[model samples]
Target chain A: MAGASFGYDPRRPVLRGIDMLVPRGRVVAIMGGSGCGKTTILRLVGGQLRPQEGSVRVDGQSVPDLGRDGLFALRRRIGMLFQFGALFTDMSVYENVAFPIREHTDLDESLIRDLVLMKLHAVGLRGAAQLYPNELSGGMARRVALARAIALDPTLVLYDEPFAGLDPISLGVVGQLIRQLNDALGITSVIVTHDVYESLKIVDYLYFVSAGRIVAHGTPDEVRRSTDPFVRQFVDGEPDGPVAFHYPARPYAEDFGIRAS
Target chain B: MTSVATGLRRVGAGTLRAIARVGFAARFFVAVVLQTPAALRRIQLTAREIYFAGVLSLVVIMVSGLFVGMVLGLQGYDVLVKYGAGDSLGIFVGLSLVRELGPVVAGLLFASRAGSAITAEIGLMKTTEQLSAMEMMAVDPLARIVAPRFWGGVIAMPLLAALFSAMGVFGAYLVGVRLIGVDDGTFWGNMQASIDFWPDITNGIVKSIVFGMAVSLIAVFEGYDAHPTAEGVSAATTRTVVGASLAILALDFVLTVFMFRGLGNT
Candidate 1:
């Protein structure tokens, strides 16, 4: 394990029982196929949902036991980029980003405006402040969501599927932006995505999750060389490996032009 | 974990949810009762919503109320003639309109009209992820979004109910004096003396408040649970109206029974 170990359990284990301590100010990416519960891991860290059997802690405050305000305070230090950017469609982009700063602080309007502008500028969308969320492209929406996420100068940023449904150009821009923001802001980031090739090129560390378990954890090259069958399937994007789409391995030899034994 | 600890946790969570639901309702009334015009930015948005709610639906409400009043006058006069109390026709129509028909019909109408409106608006917000975004930014939707509608309903219901009651009386007066050939002075005099008691008026006002609370609660509840899909929003809207309508009838029945038995309104 290369990052902080998440709590493991029998009754309700998170998608992975990863035991790797994520160093502060480093960018870590958890790469996995869809439905592997990558988002659950991030949510557990974000203090939204509690693991039924184990403890999740943020800054040493146990998530399962946190009061509402305590959980909110803990969340203030972390920013999350939800799928499709999750911008408030009812509000303009300016209001969306300003929302976090306003709720978490009593910063006066003038100071809040300056901070919101600074955040939007970081995402390179400051000019789009007056625009509604519906006007933005997918990549731009994700960027705006990123801006809102980092509004409070969060210490940790959790990005869920940043490169999902993105064009290669947009993908590269998002990847570069994620890395640049992490470095420039000196913030730790956990990117959850299935974009193995793109994420591998940028992430400092990688964890592969499959079947509610961590199959491999290490640097990009290390994980790329792992002998596990699921790891091989994920990294190589192979259709016929240990990761079978169909349930039950009983008819195991039906695919790959092989007969069942 | 021990079973007792687990049980305690379950109880605690249930209690918290109940508290939140109740708190949600109280916050709605508080916002309405204490609304200031200077909450302008938010109020501007909410006022547009209220216009569509309270004003735009006026035509249908008035039309519907018109028919109800006409029918009440016809029926009351016929029933009074049978009792050999035809001269007291105004009293029966007035009392029934004031204490019985006014609040209940308006409530049912509001549940169909504005109750569904709130549900649909909130449900759309839910489907668009607007509500979730608010939460992520630490905005309490209950306080900012829901409370005003609840209180506005409380304020509006009484006005609408009073209008409905008054319209019915006018219809009764027309039927008694012109159609049924009763004297105009006798009709008005009987109505003034028989109905319009202070107690009856108080009961009508209280019933309007209760109806407002019911409609707002059902609408907000549906909107809050609306899933992030078109189908979900449609279902939420339908449920809000139907559920609120049934709840209104039940509440009307309870209020009618309580007022007649204890308050001596019947």
Candidate 2:
């Protein structure tokens, strides 16, 4: 992505002159506070939304310029895991994993069944294939989603807050799976998350966004040693810093009617 | 004078908004129809929806039809007996049902049952981001989801309306022939002679098809346009029920005007 910027409303932009590049066969992380336009970047990359200005190119094809057919063709080569898995509730885990293949290909049912099981085994959930999405725990659902995402063996996978709302054990397992899958499949992975420690452990590079702009970015070692206050605050998990702890409001004392001392 | 002008402006703005919404819905309907071939290729999807929208509502429809027909039989008998023409009870009940009551009542029931369910299902899917997930997977939800349900309802509506009318005629039979002691042969003969296949029965079928399309379109459109939130989904479901019911009634009147213009001459 080069100088990519977008907003639902043009007047109040969510991302401003953003630029990002993910090298092939590497894991990159985009980290930021809540509502800091991290997910918007992922959407731009996925061609779900076109940037208002600038270019989003994946595999040398400009995404924003693609027509509907072109975009769908491009999307087939990419996989995305939304924040909460977004599994089709009415379908079983096996069916969810098989959906894309069924829609895009005409492979025999036997082959499709084998492929779905293989993907599920990779996610360590082959046994849970018959269960409905609502029957699984949150972490399991996310794993199912991950299995579904990589079922097609795409060259690029984008994960949006894959660690949100997971138990620590599940988070660590998910983080490990992400790294292992990236290395094993030789696919580039871009993760949008705020889980600093997990991201540092897995990612080859990091970009920290704040209020629609890249505030700080570096490798894990450099990010740890850097003196940038924004980076330090985020790293240390401070209560207040460049990103304020309190929302903007009128003076507390005045609002309570006891201002004068 | 200022207040009156402000009122006029408000009315004009409301009218324009209504027109814009109608235009959008028209475009959406076209898009849905364009995607229908793809939807039909996977016939199982539409078949499953037919089960949901049509087969599942059978109990309520049959029960309600029975009651409506029995009431008509009892009332028609009382009026006919006063005039000493009670033998025309079958024709009275059959014509009322096949011509008007069958499609209209069944459609109203379906709007509440199946139409609301479709809206709620789609709205919830949106709220949970399932539709977005489908899009990201290079699948058009309109083809995979909406079109199947639309065709399902269209196919199901006529069948359900037919079943309702059949059940209603039977109910009237039970009342007028067995209980009230009307002549069975006369009842059957009068009904067969009075209700023609082309104008009365076919017109009713056509009315039910139109109601089905109107209800299904409203349901799907409201679902697709709903805001992706819990409250928003609930509101969309409400809109589907209310909008479909109103559309069914209004379209029924308009269709009746055109289709039955020469009421007695036909």
Candidate 3:
């Protein structure tokens, strides 16, 4: 994406003058505070949203310029894991993994069944294939979503907060799987997350955004050793930094109705 | 004077918003219709919706139909007996059920049951991001989800209405002839002679179909347009029920006025 700017309301832009890139066969992570337009970037890439200015191109094709058929064709080559799994509750694990294949191909049920099982096996959840999403633990559900995301073996996979709301063990497991999957499938991965430590461990490159602008971009080692206050605050997990812990407010004394002492 | 001007402005703004909402709903309805062919190509999806929207509501519709019919029979008998026309009780119950109560009441029940269910399901799906997930997978949620439910209601509405009318006539028979001592022959003979297939039965079916379209369209549109939150889904479900009910009654009145306009001349 180059100079991408977008907002649900045009007058209040959520992303402004953004440029980011994901090279082939690499893992990149974009980190930011809540509501900083991280997920909006993912939507622009998937063509779920169009940037108001500048271009979002994937594999030499501009996303916003594509018609319905073209956009769908482009999306076929991209997979996304939402904040939660977002698995179809009505479908079983095996069926969830099989959905894209069934919708995109004319493979027989027998062939689809084998592909679904293989994907489930890759996620180490083959035994849980018949289980519904609601029946799985949060970690296990995210794993199933990982399997579903790679079912088509796309060139690119986007992860939106892949480690949110997880126990430590689950978080480690997910972080490892993301790295392992990127190498194994030779697929480029772009993750949007605020999990600083985990992303530092796996990602080849990092982009730190603040209030819709890229404040810092570096390799993980540079990010850790750098003196940039924003990067320091994020890496050190400080209570207050360039981004204040407190929202803008009136004077404390006035808020409490206390006269000056 | 300033306050009154503000009030007038508020009213004008509300009217414009309402009109804009209606326009958006009309466009959504058209999109659903455009996707109907794709929905029908995979008939099982629509069949599943019919089971949810129509088959599931059967017991309520039938029971309500029966109770309404029994009351009509008792009331019609009381009124006719005063004029020494007690034999006309079956005709009264049959006409009222077939022409008005069956479609209107069945529609009201369906709006509360099936229409609300559709909205809640779709709204919940939105809340959970399943619809967004589908879109990201390059699957159009409109074709895969909304169109099937829309067509299912359209196909099932008239059938349910017919069933309601049938059950109602049976209930009337039980009350008017079996209990009230009206001659069975006179009851049957009178109903058969007075009820016309085109004017009464067909017109009723037509009304039910229109009600079905209105209810289904409102339900799907509300669901598709719901805010992606629990409270939003709840509010959308409430709107579906209320909006569908109002649409059914208002459409029924307009249809009745047109369909039975020739009653005085006849």
The Cα local distance difference test for each model comes to: 0.78, 0.94, 0.93
Worst 10 residues of 2 chain A by lDDT: A252-261
Whichever of 1 and 3 has more TM-score, that candidate is 3
User: A-chain TM-score per prediction?
Assistant: 0.87, 0.97, 0.97
Task: Provide the TM-score for each candidate, comma-separated.
Answer: 0.79, 0.95, 0.97
Q: Sort the predicted structures by TM-score, highest score first.
A: 3, 2, 1
Cα-based lDDT at residue A84, candidate 2:
98
Fraction of the true interface contacts (Cα pairs closer than 8 Å across chains) found in each model? 0.21, 0.70, 0.64
Candidate 1 docking classification: acceptable
RMSD of each: 6.7, 2.3, 1.7
Error of 1 at B120 (Å): 4.2
Query: In model 1, which regions exceed 4 Å deviation?
Result: A1-16, A224-227, A248-261, B1-59, B71-93, B120-130, B146-149, B166-188, B226-232, B263-265
DockQ of 3: 0.80
Q: How would you encode candidate 1's per-residue C-alpha lDDT over A125-243 as one tens digit per residue?
A: 99999999999999999899999989988898889899999999889988999999999989999999999988888899987777667777888888777877777788888976767
Clashes by residue pair, model 3: none
What are the runs in model 2 whose C-alpha is more than 4 Å off? A250-261, B1-19, B262-266
Better of 1 and 3 by lDDT: 3
Ranking by lDDT: 2, 3, 1
Best candidate per TM-score, number? Answer: 3
